[model samples]
Target: MLGDDGAGPLLAEKMLANPLEHWHVIDGGSTPENVVHQIRQLKPSLLLIVDATEMGLMPGDIRFVDPDLIAELFLMNTHNMPLNFLIEQLRDDISEILFLGIQPDIVGFYYPMTDAVKKAVEQIYQALNLHYIQKAFEPLAICEQ
Candidate 1:
């Protein structure tokens, strides 16, 4: 799973490149509950949350968080949680989780992603040993497990 507009689309593309992995994207525009509901339904083994809110990330740099840690952070910060809640509530359901956040150079209406964000995406793909796949990929299971 992936969320946040800053790097969500890019990460989704990278995950799709790996034929063995399946990815679902939830952007900032979606309500928080919608993302939480999807996580409940999919029961994904991992989650990649790319956001600017996480601490210690430089504009061109990246940060990684264990899914469990993210869940704690969410509970402490937002009264309503993001997908991290599911990771906590269903820890056994997840194999591993990574929160990949980039400090975006700019985030504004009618603006394209900064070069730094785009380059970071490429770096993440290399780190994950994946290539861009140019076709439809598998859908995340919509029914509850």
Candidate 2:
């Protein structure tokens, strides 16, 4: 319910509506650590985490953050476990971990997402969907060559 803090969950809901094959979209909510077991069970090669972050940038700005810089960049600590710590726990299980950080305008409770953030979310959803669709067709394209 915290303003743009809902960015991650909103993205998760969008993803659930039209999921990609072989991809799992989990809404870790404010307690992402709780989903560690579920994530590990999937044995995914790549894990992409999307969350609202404080980057001292314009609202709606999105960046593909390096895991090492997470501690320095992540100012909001809404999650139960520190994001860096959670990453460390799953590093062994997941081959690649990606953090997509969206700069949030307001994080107050019961506030709705700002237009900038909402736009960013839609952009992210489209990009991911396009990427997966292209990937899904790769093998077929290669086979027909």
Candidate 3:
């Protein structure tokens, strides 16, 4: 949870209910170094970052971003954190790394989330159980292979 206000709380709720069941909430008041230290110590299998960014799908939209961008951000932001080195750093630890974002209508001060973002949060929570094949990119047709 990287946001300063409402986004953090909403994401915390969803993560608490997540089937995988590990949740940590760090207050935005904390310094980035504190955050980096905590992550290093815990070594979470999946680091789901919910931040205010220009990137990502709007409310009610979901998409898997290329992992390369993920690596770039982690490196530049966290003082060359190990995740910057290679996806393999997470390979032995994390199996899935997801960045669930809600395009913020407001950030930095407390304000109610936009109706669209709120609806999206709920939708994502409900859809968490939808079965997705573990490897969806595999060729399904013989000719394609």
Give the top-scoring candidate (lDDT): 2
State the lDDT of candidate 2 residue by residue for 1-145, as single tens digits.
Answer: 8999889999999889978665689999998988999999999999988889776767988776677767764456578777998898999999899877788999898898999999888878887867742232111111111
Cα lDDT over the full model 1: 0.52
TM-score for each of the candidates: 0.56, 0.86, 0.49
What TM-score does candidate 3 get on C-alpha atoms? 0.49
Model 2, global lDDT: 0.79
Predicted structure 3: lDDT: 0.44
Error of 3 at 91 (Å): 5.5
Q: Best candidate per TM-score, number?
A: 2
Least well predicted 10-residue stretch by lDDT in candidate 1? 136-145
By TM-score, rank the candidates, best first: 2, 1, 3
Instruction: Compose the digit string of candidate 1's lDDT tens values, residues 24-62.
Output: 665433244445666657777665555544343455565
Off by over 4 Å in 3: 1-5, 15-48, 56-60, 71-92, 131-145
Rank candidates by lDDT, best first.
2, 1, 3
C-alpha lDDT of residue 103 in model 1: 51
Better of 1 and 3 by TM-score: 1
